[model samples]
Target: MKFKVDRAPLLRALSHVNGVAEKRNTIPILANVLLEHDGETLRLTATDMEIAVVEEIPSTATRAGAVTIPAAVLFEIVRKLPDGAEIEFNQESAEEPLHLRAGRYATSLNVLPVDDFPAMVAGDLPHHFTIQAGELRTLIDRTRFAMSNEETRYYLNGIYLHVVLEGKKNYLRAVATDGHRLAKVDTEAPLGVKSMPGIIVPRKTVTEVRKLLDNDGADVEVALSETRIQFRIGSILLTSKLVDGTFPEYSRVIPQNNSRILRVSKQDLAAAVGRVAAISQERSRPIKLTVTKNHLTLSAISPDQGIAQEELDENSVSYDSDDVEIGFQARYLTDITDQIDAEAEFALADSSSPTLIRDTEQPAVLYVLMPIRV
Candidate 1:
């Protein structure tokens, strides 16, 4: 197998596989990337069993064959080569090592037989649809922060993506939670997903898919099955296994009615929480929020560090509830508030009930944060 490719495009393709190939794997071949030459295009594929990504780049191939090489080493070598240098890869025989040459730099790497590489069988994917990249990105960003990282309830370690109907209008919703907080965001549902089943996209796969949504105008083609999902972006395709555990019915956690309402600037609340949190430690970084008449006071206390308190103008906050005091993890408050741009409406039932936060202008996105005991 022989091919000549430009450094820039080759490096870009190599980067896509770094995360998957460099991950710790028990199988040696799994650390390598399969490269196939079809005389015109070079196909690069990397997989860690759970997820696989393939990208094709233009190249000049003198011989048509395939070989597997260390993806991390190859990427580093190609990245350090002089700019504009053309990379020449040659493997005379299956037994011989793959030879790489770029300007004055040259090296040979052990090659693994392509047949030994694990075969990724993409079973029948019956459901297919397309969504704008920008819209999909928004859905992920709004809810990803709330995904559970704990291993016990593995089902909550991903975002639950499903299609819903609101007032006869179709909508796609992404919901994530970690027992402490929950985030739910909705967007107009794309065509052909009406019959699609709810799927829990793993945290790692969600991150990789998010990287492909950089182009706002591009449309991402999605294919789904019972346990697998595929995303095609330009010349790249990513396939990942869905989480096996069943997701909890998130609807039950959402508060149905919270009579007390408070509206304040999202920026102000975020800043106040951040400042107070500075004195508190990670494990017990709880901030107390006291609301009365038309005023809100934020305070945090730490045994080792000094206390912090900030008072905001009563006139700037609009509240219809009686005086109440609630505690929350300062980091959690900042994370949810960061998703909102303008005014944030806070609905509180009491000091112990979960608080619902929402942006008045974006009714489609809602965040539920459980109160913390201080």
Candidate 2:
């Protein structure tokens, strides 16, 4: 197979697929990328079993053929080539090695038989929908932070995406939690896939799909089946296997009635917690919030280091009953506050309770954090 493609277009497509290709794995074929030229367009594909990314773009095909080359090597060669250099890929047959040529650089890479490259059978996806890339990005950005990394609970390692009803209106909701914190966001669901099957989108797939949505004003076509989901972004397509376990009933963990509400400037609150926690103990990184009528004091103390305290002028900070003392992970508070551009509030019942951090203005997103013992 012989084909010529612009360095920029080829690099962009290869980078996306490179994300799923492993640098080192027990399976030799998993470490390489499959390149196929169908006479007019060249298709590049890479997969790590769980996720696969494919890109098909216009290229000049001299001899129609395919080859498997090291993903990292191809990416690096294209990346280091001179500006505007066109890359030439050639493979005489499956037995011969692939040769790459660009400017003064010429490299030969061993090729693996394309048939050995594991191919994932696309399921019969009955549900097809179109979603604005901008909206999908919001769902990912808001809840991805809460996805668990612990392997014991495999379901928790990915975001739970489903189409459901919020009251009477249909909405697409993304929920993620790591046991200590939870983030949930919802938006109007695209009309066509109202009956779309709910699935656990794996962490790597979530990350890759988010990257594809970065281009402004792009529309992504989504297709879902029982075991996999496909996302078509521009000329690129990604297919990911759905994680197979039931996510915990996270709705039950959210506290509905936390009477004490503490409203504070997002920047001011995040700053106070950040500064104080720098001197707090390492185990807890706990900062105390003392709410009063018109002032909120943030303080943290570490016997080995020192004490840090700061106060924010709260228009009204007193609790429903009296001033309440609550301890929280300073980092968590700062992260939640940073997510909101506007001023926010945290509702709490007492020192030993979950806190609801919410945007003071937006109606769609909610973050919950379980209190940390100091």
Candidate 3:
């Protein structure tokens, strides 16, 4: 195989494909990337069994052939090469090392037989739809933080994506929870998605797909089956296996009739929480919130260190309900507040029940947080 390509495009393609290839692999071929040239364009593919990424770049190929080379090694070499340099790749046979050449640098990489690379067969995908990049980004950014890392409840380790029907309107929803906190966000459902089955998109797949949606104006084509999902972004394609588990009915956990209401500036609340949480030594970093008629106080204490408190009066917060005191993890509070734009609304029942939080600027997103003992 022989081909010539510009450094910038080749480096970009390698970087994307290399992420799917694991550094340490029990099978030798799983650590390598398959490169195929068809005398016009070059195709690069890498897979880790669960997920696969494939990208095609325009190239000038003198011969049509294919080979597999170490993914990490090839990526590093291309990334370090001089920008705008024209790179040449050549190989006489599968048994020979692949030769690479730039302006003043030359090297050869050990090649594995292309036949040894396993192909990830994407079986028939019946459901097809398209989504705007910006909408997809919103759905993922708002909910991924709450995804569970605990392996015991594998169902909560991913974002649950499903279609919700209300009368004649259809909404696409994404929900994630780690038992202590939950995030739910929704957007208008695209056409042809109403009949699709609910699927749990694994955490790793969510992360990789998010990286590809850099251009908000671009449209992403999605096709899926019960077991697998595929995303086509420009010239790149990503296929991943859906998490094999049933997500719990999340609506039962959401609070319905919380009477107390408090509205506060997102920036002010986040800053005060950070200041008080700095003094706490506990792993949970519990912070106490005391809300009275129109005043709010945030405090944290540690037996060995000290106590820190910050107060926000009626000018900074708007509250008219009865006094209430609640404790919550500092990290959880910050995570939910980060998604809010200007103001955050808290609907509370008491210090014992779960508190519902919402972004005042966005009505379709909501969060539920369980209190921690102070």
Model 3 lDDT, residue 50, Cα: 90
TM-score of each: 0.96, 0.95, 0.97
Which regions in candidate 1 have their CA more than 4 angstroms from the true location? 314-316
CA lDDT of every candidate: 0.90, 0.85, 0.94
Give model 1's clash tally. 0
RMSD of candidate 1 to true structure, Å: 1.5
Candidate 2 lDDT, 17-84, residue by residue in tens: 88889777899899899998989999999999888899998999989988898898888888888889
Find the 10 residues in a row with the least total lDDT in model 2.
313-322
Model 3, which residues run further than 4 Å from truth? Answer: none
> Among all windows of ten consecutive residues in candidate 1, which has the lowest summed lDDT?
17-26
Best by TM-score: 3
Backbone atom clashes (below 3 Å) for every candidate: 0, 0, 0
TM-score, predicted candidate 3 vs. hidden true structure: 0.97
